[model samples]
Target: MLKDRNITLTVPAMPEYVDLVRLTLYGIASKMKFTFEDIEDMKVAVSEACNNAVLHAYDKDDGTIEVRFAFVKDELSITVRDYGSSFTIEENKETPAMHGKSIDEIQSGGLGLYLMQALMDRVEVEHGGGTAVTLTKKRQRTEEPA
Candidate 1:
C-alpha cells in the first residue's frame, strides 16, 4: 500500500495566487493518475475555495491562504484554510430557499460552497478562529468516455 502523503502550499490571499494552488493540485493529482476531467473539476473546486478566502477572509491583502493536499487510501483531500474570518455551517440543514426564485432575485454569495460540493466527492467546513474547507475526491480506475 502506498503510504499517505501530504503537500502544503501557502499563498497570499490574492486572485493572482489562486492559479498557483491550481497548478500544484494539477501536479499532485496527475501524479496520482486522476483523469483529466476529474482533475479539471478539482481545479475549479479548489479555485472557488481559494477565491472565497481571497475575497471574504480578509479586510486587506495581508492575509494568507493555506492549502493542504493529503493523499490517503486512494483519496485526495484538499483543505483551503484562511485565518482572517470565520463562518458557521450547521449540519444537516438546508440553506435558505432559492428554489423558484428569479436569477436576479438570488444573491451573489454562497454559490462557491454549492459549486465546491457539486464538484468534489465530499466537502467539509470547520470554523472558529478561521475557516477550513476540505474538498475530497476519490481516485477511480475506469476508462474515460471518448
Candidate 2:
C-alpha cells in the first residue's frame, strides 16, 4: 500500500536554517525507514537545495524560501522554491570541467545542484519568476526470514 504525507515550511534565506532543514530531513527520513547512509545523503542533498535557495535565489534576503516534503510509498519527494531568477542546468555543468583552475576560473555556484543530483534518485528543476527543485529517493527494502 502507498502512504503519503506532505509538509511545507518557509524559512528566512539565512545560512543557519540549513542545519534546521537537515535535522528535519533526518527525522522524516528516519521515520520513512531510510538507512543511516541514505538519511545522511538525503540530509546533504536537502541542505544543498536550501542553501542554494538562500544564497542564489534570495541573495538579498528580501524574500522567503519555501520547502515542501512529500513521502509516498517507499519514495520521498522534496521541493524547494524561491521567488528569484531561474538558472540553467546546462550552464552550470560547465563548471566541473575546469579542473585545477583557480576559484575565479571555476564557476562560483551550482556545484551543490550537481551534488544533489548525484545523491538523489531523481532531481528536476523548473525555472520562471521563481525556481522549484523536485527531488525523489526510494527506500531500500529488506526481506525477513520466516
Clashes of each: 0, 0
Q: Candidate 1: give its CA RMSD in angstroms.
A: 3.5
What are the lDDT scores of the predictions, listed in order? Answer: 0.90, 0.83
**Candidate 1 Cα misplacement greater than 4 A, ranges:** 90-105, 143-146
Q: Across residues 36-67, which tens digit of lDDT does each residue of candidate 2 receive? A: 99898888888888888887776587777788
- Model 1 steric clash pairs: none
Worst 10 residues of 2 by lDDT: 91-100
CA deviation > 4 Å runs, candidate 2 = 100-108
- The top-ranked prediction according to TM-score is 2
Best-performing candidate as measured by lDDT = 1
User: What's the lDDT for residue 57 in model 2?
Assistant: 77
Q: Provide the lDDT at 122 for model 1.
A: 99
lDDT (Cα, tens digit) per residue for candidate 1, span 82-139: 9988766553244667899998888776778889999999999998778999999999
TM-score of 1: 0.86
TM-score of each: 0.86, 0.88
